[model samples]
Target: MKKIKPLFLLLILNTISYAQGCSDAGICSVGNSFSNEIQESKNGIELGSIFGKGEADVISISSYITYTRNFSERFSLSGKVTYSQASGEFGTRGQFGDAYAIGNYKFKKMTNKQWSSLFGFKFPFSSANLKINGYPIPLDYQASLGTFDAIVGITFNYKKWDFNSALQLPIINNNKNSYFKEYSGTDDFPSTNLFERKPDVLFRSNYTLKTTNQKFTFRPNLLFIYHLGEDSYKNIFGNRERISGSEGLTINGNLITSYSINSKSSIELSLATPFVVRTIRPDGLTRSITAGFTYKRSF
Candidate 1:
């Protein structure tokens, strides 16, 4: 019985290390970029599932409150907090909570315009807690991974068609420390350092089509991720090892259909899938699917 606590903590740590980048529950940076166009009044919620290639599967739910205020004709700011949880078979379960604040400055903008450019920065802070029971013993642990990112992008809007391309660079990387503690008691156990702040770069492109009524929209996006620094990947199952570099290509297509219940209220549903590229396979090649909905209102 005394051994159960340590084992549980280890399981939690393991789940977080491998599952961080794979889950779809967190606030997607790209999604926030378009917040200005979304009718602002109430918050939104998205519930989805994450399917891994093998034994790893996750069901996730995320929600956010978006506020968009335009200070000038070309400047706007949006802030939101997103929470998500992932649970699967084999006693694998994890939760991620994130808060993001982003400011967008538009270079050129017109209603139903075909071209626009925006410079922005996204400061996202996140915390994760994981737990697994199937291990020889129960394991539970928590970690905080946070980073500040700068973004520059160009958007093209053609009637009902919208296209966006963007690049993101991490300006400040926050290294998080992981510690082990007894699951039941206030005892401190050996600590393990899981991840360090390393430079990260991301490129993404998206295309969206608006319905005739402009209430429904369909968006498909391609995201490419590259790690620019020598960051180490360690887990409860092994010793500290450094990953030379990492790259991932993900294609996510989401169908968001919105119904204007009234002038101030709307509901939306989104479905998305991420296909894995060989260059970015961490444990191995993987694939995932995410689907959810959101309810929004305008003040």
Candidate 2:
């Protein structure tokens, strides 16, 4: 156990280093909108619903409400709520929800510009309950986890075409440990008393291109997520050693089209897919597709 401590620390450090260097890393960003827990569309006052599907018998349903209000033309406040449910055949089913509030301050404003810079802090709160099958021998149990994250990011926007890029980082995170570990027969699960607080790092980029007549917009995005501390998972039924990790990565792509009718309201349709790039096997190789619509009434 003492020797394993060094190895575990090394893994955690490596994950953080890689997350910080994602821009230079060769990992290709997937192209798609609606693939993210947080919507990439940077607009004021939007509401939408999302439905996602994937191979391996997976399904997800979600709804979102977002509002952005500008202050003094250079500062803005944005908030969003996402409620989602995900279920898979490989002994996984759960419901998760996230709520975030961000403050944006524009540094440079360019008229008809192709690029701009905005800085902001994101406060993300998440909660989930998951269950695994073939566990505890014929009985299933619920496991829950919750987290609070403090994040910051900078965004670059283009005007001639609807395109944007962003990079975000989490400076602080508060996670619940009891929700992640399971009990063992001989060795009791570590008490939550020893849990430690840690931060996560994430990188994201998004771009939008409009076709002729501006009837359709193509949006693509990439996100790389890395957790910096140990998280534990157990198979109580198997009576084996628990699995623990401090790092993982996910890649996603999406395409969406918006059709305008009058002026105040438009209809949007989207398809999104996400893949786990690097992580523990079985739990890492997962994919999903989401199709949804947006209806807006301008005030």
Candidate 3:
């Protein structure tokens, strides 16, 4: 294809639908994104793709289609949809992932520093229950989290640096998964049956370096994602059990480079890796490393 897209909105850390499947799912890359930008038109679209290695060396891939409508200099809205897949020891699976819609409002004041508020939501196509051989697969294998989540975030810019923070709250969890430890192939990755995920709070900081002509840009980013509480799942007895140690933080380091093909279009490459990790990630948001590309245009 000619292009691909980016977002929890990322594990936008794993880097939107992780920067297509990057962020926690698509949270970090919505609305007025946290990355460096050279806005050339009021309406725009992007195609992005992500390739990653997750737990147990599962090879994962995702693609996205994104559209943005800029109402003015201070406001904009964006919609992104994604499809994801993976191949591990078990088998290969692919499907549409989540959909996100976000609105952003930039503060009118603060000339030296621009402040923007972000709000959005995630809609899943599957219930985190992708199955094979009559059994539910691990989260890393499924394309969607099967949860409806609300997202709110803020972005602040000072010169070449941008700071962003976001919260993703699960308004409804419809995950009907049944991948238990018993289904494991002699390895104990946690059971995700009836997985009940907690809220996530994420922070990101990045610095942008651009050439004198502003045609090429380089960015280094750091992301921190914290699980608000321990996740839970129903056991065989139907008892809700908390997955201990599920409440913690994951840290990722990201690097990005972009090329401006013209005034109305551009191309970007992003890379991310986990520098710090949690012991147990049952939410299916785990990734060891990620790489992706985005082609953007303003019209």
Candidate 4:
């Protein structure tokens, strides 16, 4: 009983520390130290759902499948495909979402710490075809923006703590109908513009605690994100228009729990919510919950 006291206290504090930040990390940032959890797995598969509600009484739900493969001792590759649906005060939309690929390389290693860099690309796969009463809706309900994005990230791990940061930049312009094209009459709103891509920077840190028996683990995380600029677009009248107050900062807290089902598999539950918002975001998620399971087997 005496030996379990410290461990029990840590468990209690971890549960209260709370997780995931902004749209950038979502549930993926919760308790994901990356160094051991991902590198140790030869091949792994994960299926999960993300559900959130935010401004304008909007609710966003997405389902995703992620696969990871370790090609070498220090190199790994992963991919994710998602389907998302959203509805609420604005409108409703359902479609396949962006697909992304990630590659990681570990360049430094020590007895208890590791450092790695990751690069990835996100491919646009969904169409922005949301309508209301046969009229085009706003951009808030679309599942995808149809832009190709490149991501670069770095991660560091020490013991049970992890730190990671990533930058996401859109490399290709979205040319699809990602704009407000419908109004009562074309003459009334003839200058609607299509949004341009913007950049996102995200940072997250987390600590994990494992039960003495090692069957369960608890993790708490803090996250921050900054938007570099507001989205811009060309209006129907050929004028450049910028979405004001789009650039801002977000802070979030996250908590995650994982239970080992066996030596090769585990189930995870995660929660993420924003604690601060410092901008005019007309389209953003404020809170989300995720439940998923992961399975790993040697190849």
Best by lDDT: 3
Order of the predicted models by TM-score, top scorer first: 3, 4, 1, 2
lDDT of 3 at 182: 72
Q: Highest TM-score, which number? A: 3
> What 10-residue stretch in candidate 4 is worst by lDDT?
183-192
- Which pairs, if any, clash in model 1? 8-138, 8-139, 8-140, 9-139, 9-140, 41-297
Q: lDDT of each prediction vs. the true structure?
A: 0.44, 0.41, 0.77, 0.63
Question: Candidate 2: misplaced stretches above 4 Å?
Answer: 1-43, 54-56, 87-96, 111-145, 158-206, 221-230, 233-249, 274-276, 281-285
Arrange candidates, best lDDT first: 3, 4, 1, 2
Candidate 4: pairs in clash: 18-254, 19-253, 19-254, 19-255, 20-254
Instruction: Please identify model 3 stretches exceeding 4 Å from their true place.
Output: 1-24, 35-40
Q: Which regions of candidate 4 fall more than 4 Å away from where they truly are?
A: 1-21, 24-33, 38-41, 89-91, 175-192, 286-299
Model 1 ranges with Cα > 4 A deviation: 1-28, 35-55, 88-96, 110-144, 175-193, 197-215, 220-231, 234-240, 275-287
lDDT of 2 by residue, 1-299 (tens): 35434533543343333222121111121111212112233355667775544333455555667776555445566666665555544344543345556665554456644333344443333322233452321001111123444444444455423343343443443422322233423221232321233344555565555656765555444555555555344333433232444345555444445675545556776544444543432222223334567765444
What TM-score against the true fold does each predicted structure earn? 0.61, 0.56, 0.89, 0.80
Model 4, span 57-93: residue lDDT tens: 5567777777878887788888888777878754577
TM-score of 1: 0.61
Worst 10 residues of 2 by lDDT: 23-32
Over the stretch 76-181, how does candidate 3's per-residue lDDT look in tens digits? 8889999998888778999999999888787864655877888888999999898877767888888888899999988888987889999989999999989887
**How much is the lDDT of residue 222 in candidate 1?**
52
